[model samples]
Target: MKKIFILSALAFSLAAVAQNQKQAMTKPKTTPNKAVVYQVFTRLFGNQNTTNKPWGTIEENGVGKFNDFTDLALKEIKDLGVTHIWYTGVPHHALVRDYTKFGISNDDPEVVKGRAGSPYAVKDYYNVNPDLAVDPAKRLEEFEALIARTHKAGLKVLIDIVPNHIARKYEGKTNPAGVRDFGADDDTSVEYKRDNNFYYIPGIPFQVPTSDTYKPLNGEKNPLIDGQFSENPAKWTGNGSRLARPDINDWYETVKINYGVRPDGSKDFPQLPEGFAAKEVKAHFEFWKDKDVPNSWVKFRDIALYWIEKGVDGFRYDMAEMVPYEFWSYMNSAIKAKNPNAFLMAEVYNPKEYRNYIHLGKMDYLYDKVETYDKLKEVIQGKTMPDPISDIQNGLADIEHHMLHFLDNHDEQRLASPEFAGTPEKGKPLMVVSATISTSPTMIYFGQEVGEPGKEDAGFGTHSRTSIFDYIGVPHHQRWMNGGKFDGGQLSQSEKDLRDFYKRLLNFTVSSPAVPSKFVDLQKVNREHMSYDAGLYSFARWSDKQKMIVVANFSWLKDSFFELRIPAELIAQWKLRDGNYVLHENLYGRRHALLKVVGGQGTATISIKPSESFVFTLAD
Candidate 1:
């Protein structure tokens, strides 16, 4: 009787395993929708005041509030085809604004960047910036409402997580139960400890940075602007400056966080396993689930989890490369364990560490600034040909999906600035290439669509890049704001045209099947033709359902008429026989071309105007 029961149980277990295998094999594979991230400086998005005052106070140049992002405003942004809204500078940072009555401590002007303060120098991780709220005490509640409103508008929320550093006067006023501020229990007598929150220079007093031409508030008088800060033992500056008195160029407003890495640059924490890079995020999480970690690591991990719990869809990690990858494996894995679909992007510039960060660190994306953005800038400025772009894309082919492409961001100069392309029209072709060339996410700054040149010298930040450190209004974006109407009622004809083009292009990019499909470079083959010049670039993207041929003219002063050829290999890949095919311009549907296919190869006469591009699709 026992043997018969054992046989029956074995048979039942085998049948269950077979059923599970069949279900797994028959599960439909779904492709992920590409993300279109709209990064807006939260403090500057809705300010309609056009007082272009240098070194202006908040009253002189109005400040945008959380309430400014009304339902109408969010709907307009969503209609622009944005999937995620990265609300930059949401965290409480060191600023000159006084909210002493609300029980918030004052930040010394000597350690603050501007009247509005640098968003990167975070003062409190547990709370939102008081300046963004209608009531100083209700800041967190207002921010939570914004998150809810963003979700109701069919968009995700993204905020900054500055893991590498924090403001020199780090304080968390709204800590959770039993939570403590960073460096609260550190032994300051030693320079390095495995669990110490910061690296210290024992017995050295902190000295404020000195600059001949620059001042904290442009020589404005304030009680805390005396160029004296109180720190008995100076900590290392955010930019890794070891001196007690950091240089003018150093990030003196913030102090670095130590994550188990000693002064000799060796990690005291546990390293990831040899094969962990290829492992899943859950596996990485399991690896660190029971292991002991440094106090700084746990603090950062808790901070990220806290934000995730607060309905933030993701984070944009600042200077992620400065922090160790193992900490990311721990922190990000913890985050993924909570929300598997969280969007994790980092600002890592080194090309060599791209794969490590993406795979081992479990980052969803990294900025493609150094290679793609810089090369595109060179091409737009007439400094280099677009030929190297194909190489750059191919070099990072294994990790292309992890690279986020953008023509403009807060750190880079605006596309319309004189230092950049000098006009918003020049960004048309570059935008096409940056958006459609890869399977990665695409980002655009707040004022990019309507062409804010960021030419104001607002306080500490100069022209070309929008000021994140001062109270100022974006003029061109304000035109679209139209005094809180959230409509483009006051936009000029040219500005309207530009915004229209962006809407069409971005909407098509997000919904097109061919965008995330396989790409074939046409620039290499087209280089042999006489009409195909360095100023022109072409490519093909095709899948089982859709096929597209993209061509762009980067020249600002020339038009191009070329015999765009499709090699026999690509024709065969598209399953085309010897016949004629009609290619319709999908951008505007205004132009169509006839492609003659003979002996499996295809050729068409294509004409493109300067700073114009087209995504030609095969007609049904």
Candidate 2:
């Protein structure tokens, strides 16, 4: 009788424990820290040249190498709260420099853009850029070492994967055994083949564009500049131009890769079955296990896998929407199969295809340039009101976590440039809003924090965006480089202050647990109650244990104080005791305030400086 009673009591205890564990699992989980990406043009990060002459040769203007990212440099980046280092233009792209002595084939001058050539015009898939290596013969080895070092620094690596097109001259010299070069097995006789690598314009010869604004070698004479690139049957341009000679403004230096997409706007391969959007990466991989994709899809998949195997953590697919989503379904699934936590982001612009790419294609993130960055730019430029930010957040509420926000990138103008906000200080408010707006990742160009205006007139590249096709120097960023000491010895006081602000903002976002939690927009409520103007925007981010009120004053010249009102509904939802509470400021630690709540309504008087932002955290 005693044994039976003991067994029954133990069974009851086990059942109660199981019930408690099940309830715990059903509760909502707290979100972790958001990702902060630091994008650096590998060829420009370490260059200390001030000579930014138009079309300057590498001998005249210096070029940065992979070895430049020493341990100290990476540690400095990590200290800035960066989680990933996006090394742009790391592959072996088309360049004017001759590497013939290294057994590499020469690229035609007529078909190449700029003196250094466009980074998007890739030459070899399995090799690194010779210009980015101290010794051209050991470029690949050096790149592998860089990848290893990046991993050792506790930072993930992201490199570009331009799948929509490739350089006019595509060769796989360093490919592994049994790996064939693109177009090697392709049939050039047919214009449209499901298996063909490129679209052909039969019976037509490739011609260089006749533009008065551009010269093959910037009017510099060269033996290779014959004004003719021999292609019996010309291929379509990278921008989908089917002309034998593409327009100068088009992507004339690159040829589009055909991934079973016919010229008639029809697909040659099988499309995803219905309801595939509801599946996971594993299911997607299984669905395509016995399937046959196009040869181009396989080639790109192999390319991505090659980098992933080389210790590359992720890929930023260039113009991802230009390629079919089906190919992404196959390629990204294969990548996930290899590394489930791979960071797969893409440059997808179409809002219509956003969910399809994220859900069905298994992309981890996409460029938020159109909805988030563009709206933020409008507010900064005084072209639009700040009210749209709330709408943008609501519109993308479902996939806000998958949109990556940024103020500057290679394709956009620098914040300090005259073409942009005309000063880096204007970016302070913008950075705060962009970073804390959603659960999305935030990125910044290498020199953006130090105010690299990119005013240098690089050949074949103009103002606004940084030049990815020339040997030019970034003036402001060089000061921070400090002659490769990886210190800010030469930075001005104001520049140092700005960098400090960026460090604080990024580090806080990456370390704060409340950032990825619930977000409540205070714009509408503050606009009505506090008499806040269109130049001011406010929002609240909170978790069970922490809360923050973010306010950004976009006014270029106005400084004012306003009563920040917390709505009664939110107060009730938070279940806070109506009493006096102290709030601590995150930016400037000296700013603290007392919050007064009466009958479920809370209000705090806060002062904001002109073109400044305040991140206030609730303190117990």
Cα deviation of 13 in candidate 2 (Å)?
50
- Candidate 1 lDDT tens digits, 78-170: 999799999999999999988889989999989988889999999999998998998989999999999999999999999999999999999
Model 1, residue 370: what's the lDDT? 96
Candidate 2: worst 10 consecutive residues by lDDT?
A: 1-10
lDDT of 2 by residue, 546-569 (tens): 677888998888876778889998
TM-scores of all candidate predictions against the true structure: 0.94, 0.94
State each model's CA lDDT, in order.
0.88, 0.85
By TM-score, how accurate is candidate 1? 0.94
Per-candidate clash tally: 0, 0
Please report how far candidate 2 places residue 383 from its true position, in Å.
Answer: 0.9
RMSD of 1: 12.3
- Predict model 1's lDDT versus the native: 0.88
